[model samples]
Target: MKNFEIIANLLKEIWPEHHAKLTSEICQLSSDDAFLLDYIAEKIILIKKDKLKQAIKNYKQTCAVIVQEEIHFRRTQSYRLKTEQQADTEIYSNSSFMDMYLDGLLISQLFWSNHFKVFQFFCSSFLTQISKDDTLNRFVEIGPGHGLFLSEIVKKLPSRECLGYDISESSLRHTSQALQSLECAANVQLINKDIYNLPTDQNFDAIILSEVLEHLEAPQEILTKLSHHLTPKGLLFINVPVCSPAPDHIYLFKTPNEVQDMITSCGFRVNETRYFPMTGYSLERAIKSQATISVAAICQLST
Candidate 1:
């Protein structure tokens, strides 16, 4: 409660126009769900309070860019991020920019309607369903930015060994700090490594790749590699945004079916799927208008 109050106050001060709406949306969350977000805010504030205001401002700027690009996409039916070179130049090499971007994203996970709802599906659906399996003892998350999913994995499956892989040391560091702040890093190993370089023989019972697909040039390759890394019966959770245009997003998925098709093509069978359209838009309206719609899928390797 205290942490939520402090962070909410900070957001209100930094972005007064959006704060009331954020508050209204947050009030709709179940008490337990609300507490989890508050707890996350506490850890983030403890870790980045010094730069929190700037991060909020950066998020505002990031949203502005996305809005402009989204308009262009709707008109042109093309994403501005067309090549790997652009992503490398604009996103991967810029350390300060990435820091601000990551900070804003962490806040978005808490306050953004679609993002929060997708995470809720992850918690109530995917995680809950997987928790039924007593044999699931090992877990890995690719690009676990902000450590929310990793921490939740540890909390839900305390006995499972957890691994988080990310190419950015700063991103991994933030995840580590977040886990430690939540006092759940004991079973987590944060590795500064890329998925392509991971040992071939290593496998996991569950793998999480959320919001990372949109950043890749060839998502199919990564998904294929992940399939190789998953045990035969392993479950994989993927979250991607369709018709979403962001500064760093490269791969453009046009529909939810495209996402599921990609999964199937990569050797995974879609077990369950959930869609969360952007706030203020219904699923049908979002699809018709080409608005951002998040697709969260739970999958397993095909026989």
Candidate 2:
């Protein structure tokens, strides 16, 4: 808890009001997970301290866009972007901006209370599901953006070989540094390629597509393709946001059932689903108000 205390102090320096809530939430994490949070917090402070203020500003701007988009959605019952090309112009294709955007994302996970809930869910529920599956030997993560999730996997499942694919150079760099910083000895490969470019003949015992689905124009297509790479009994973990709009987020899922139904339609039988509402909101409130909620699921190939 000393490491968490140090992180809490640092967070207090940045955002005094959030100190108590951030400390309480972080304290709830398991020891190793709490340390990982502290590590990421320290990394942000060391490498991007000057940019932290800008990152917070950018996050607020993103929130503004989300609010605007929600109004548009209410009026038209449609997402603002219908294609990836439009989204590219909006965020992902811009390398410098994307780097800042990723940093802001890390900052949110560390200091923002609601975003912290998503992190906590992954650390506890998602990790628990993976740990129970002793047969898993090979693992792959698609769009392992900040690398925290994949680093946890490599640290916990040291005997399992791991591979990660990401289309963004910034994501790949962060993921590589995260894994190396953790001193993970597990055999690992980080490939900079779109999922379509990956070999079709290879399969994995576990596949993770966390926080990657809602950004695409065709999430279902990616899910279908990934289904082929998953072994018959392999585990698949996916995380998506409901009514969560960012500069890069294109597809809008309005409800958790929509996510569940989409995964089921893609030929995976969902084993577990966890929904974390945005801070200061209940699940029902989030759904009714079109507020942000993180929805994660674990699944297996349908028989």
Candidate 3:
């Protein structure tokens, strides 16, 4: 059986209630994305098979929590992410809690339709941009949680120098282990540093900031910093969720336009933008219902 099939069976056996919905989403995956998901499944089996069941449980529970939070958001029109200090104390500082959270998030990129589509957008749009630009050689991904984006970079653009930065040592370690399992860590450097501490003189030809903006207290500051670090002809791929409520998410983007405006105002000229509504919600319906929507944008520095 393919790794994805094996893991699907495992999820079915453990979470029968979610089987039909998950199977539907799996069937909707494109061939390339399905392959990428299989690759991730194979790595999980190799590295964390003993903990796979628990991870799936965590993912299911997290989904439930998000559903409730989304309900609250719909009622209040505000996200639960009130402050960074709360996130630091309640989510980031608790190692065991983060272990479960990260494990669930890794699975989310595979099964969550919006998350999967955002990754697909990154793979198609960002990679195509870099492949056509010979000058785009150096790559950096800020807050490369789970190492999926960096793995794609090192795999497709093998000659490109790559860097991954995270403020948490444990998060960096998790990302490193993920790359190591895929055997793509040979050319990728994982840095234990805050985004502000990144070397000012070092500019990169490509930068990826996926699902990171929502976690920050001031996302515009990081976006501005990224603009300064990008090469004159460099491209950036960034993903942020609108109306998404999570334990660690701080900044709340209320709509796709809001997300786009924030990026454009932060010294970027938007090259392309794709908005992916969560599964079972159409873009219009999501907007009308105030549902979560993932906004993926490809940008260049505004001259």
Candidate 4:
């Protein structure tokens, strides 16, 4: 939603730097270079700008293509790894928030320190889905582990300017690095603040409560605090793992339907719930019983 005049001014500022880089490459050519002789210096500058402009346009198109291809790739492989994770989840006799945090640190994109490419790719795909829908802007994510979600948001919707809050200092450190790598780092702010200290003056276009609520001894407190922080007309995305066991899934919602009720009770109106097809449970049984591994939703703010 930016004016062309503003964009024009930005292009003016950008052109100088672009020209400098373009010319720098030409400067490397020897004076005896046949191509340089064919065109006058003035024409060379114009051609350089023209080529640079073409490259920029191509890069934008390439990003879109890459996103589309990635979506297809994820859809194809969703089941195999999902089942593998579920089998691993069953091995944990007891898990806590701290354990989940550590596990995520090792494998989740939220933290760049983990040096895991697959997790980073997954986070990017997740954000791509969330951002394509305009309703999901003005975002805030709670307990975003290493901030992988923030990094993806930074890349996809630089105009949105998201903020994230979590209780762990180490997690915040890694999240900062993850966002910075995506070049959308300016759009997000990470705070080592608790849910009780949730900022009230700021309003979000979307709220993300991913995997953090179930770890809390009082999930209601987190939900209510988030309810107050959400924008009156914004979207909320809450993700909870269902049948899949984890070290930190101390409290369970069993199904997306159950979580929907809890969200409605807390004053938010749930609009849609999609169960992430999980492994271990037979597809037929999971569909009938409504027991899946994860829940993500689009929600409307409650009055």
Per-candidate Cα lDDT values, in order, are 0.85, 0.75, 0.84, 0.52
Q: Which stretches of candidate 3 lie over 4 Å from their true place?
A: 27-40, 43-47
**Candidate 2 residue 241 C-alpha distance from true site, Å:** 0.5
State residue 150's C-alpha deviation in candidate 4, in Å. Answer: 1.7
2 or 3, which is superior by lDDT? 3
Collision pairs in model 4: 95-247, 110-146, 110-148, 138-205, 146-175, 242-293
**Per-residue accuracy of model 2 over 213-288 as CA lDDT, tens digit each:** 9889889999999999999878888888887766677788888999999999999998878888876678888888
Worst 10 residues of 2 by lDDT: 1-10
Q: Which ten residues in a row have the lowest lDDT in candidate 1?
A: 40-49
Model 4, which residues run further than 4 Å from truth? Answer: 1-137, 280-283, 287-292
Q: Best TM-score goes to which candidate? A: 3
Give lDDT tens digits, candidate 4, residues 113-200: 1122223323444455666777756788887764555555665577776888876665565456555543556778778877677757
lDDT of 4 at 17: 59
Clashes of 3: 0
Model 3, residue 207: distance off in Å is: 0.7
Q: Which should have the higher lDDT, number 3 or number 4?
A: 3
* Residue-by-residue lDDT tens digits, candidate 1, 229-278: 99987899999999888878889999998999999999999988999998
Candidate 3 lDDT score at position 88 = 78
Sorting all predicted structures by lDDT, with the top scorer first, yields 1, 3, 2, 4
TM-score of each: 0.90, 0.82, 0.93, 0.55
